[model samples]
Target: MNNKTRQFFVAALMAASLGTVIAAQAAGAVESLRGRDVETQSREPGKYATEKDGPPIERNYVQQPPLIPHKIDGYSITTNFNKCMDCHSWTRYRETGATKVSLTHFKDRDGKELSNISPRRYFCNQCHVPQTDAKPLVENTFKKAEGLR
Candidate 1:
């Protein structure tokens, strides 16, 4: 072949080889997917933020999780759709000494009243959680009356 044709063939091969190297380099940085076993994946365990890790969103001073100190795993204290409600439900929790769900959970989204635990209350973690080991976003000396000492 003439010089021009030979040069063109060489350039094409060089481009193809360079592309292969780039693709190989990119594969290393890719996230290595773990096995399908749900038990092992981070998502299977579900992540939670502690009060300290969480941005200082103002909580209803009167309403809060009474006993839990860590993000409750998605175990339902009561038999129902996954949420923290299983123990907090009034019907079953009293025996367990778990804090009974608040009375307001009985209200429906439309403001209708129903007896027993409200279906909307099924999501227990929506409001209550345990303390977390994290840094406070900002500093404050505010304390409860007892803490003043």
Candidate 2:
């Protein structure tokens, strides 16, 4: 190999070894499966407000699914059971004051109608998400569609 290429590789190896040694000495940190020091890339979770039950947030676009207006931190949704259906199901929403599940949720991928929520749409979190009182992590120029205004 040329002298410059050989020197670059040697320098890179030295830097990597030095980082590993320093990390080990500093915190007894372990190397990840990818050979990175685990402590080198870590951050605490961001704080967010505990959202309260409220009216549904307005959608910014035509096809946007409605956002959950309440916190669902402990709600359970498994293959055999869905806690969301307890209140949002057609039979219960009216009595519970919760919005009814959309009619579209009852259709299969092939557009065939079903008697119950389709398996593909049973997991509400896949499309519906709750909003939090957190500041935007970055600035953006996003605007609602003109028709929505």
- Measured by lDDT, the strongest candidate is 2
Off by over 4 Å in 2: 1-46
Error at 119, model 2, angstroms: 0.6
22-54 per-residue lDDT for model 2 (tens digits): 988689565443243222332323334545778
| TM-score for each model | 0.43, 0.69
Model 1, span 16-112: residue lDDT tens = 9999878877886433333233233233322323432233343434444444543454466555465544555666688756656676777888878
Q: Please give the CA lDDT of all the candidate structures.
A: 0.55, 0.81
Candidate 2, run of 10 with poorest lDDT: 37-46
Relative to the unseen true structure, what is the C-alpha lDDT of residue 41 in candidate 1, on a scale of 0 to 100? 23
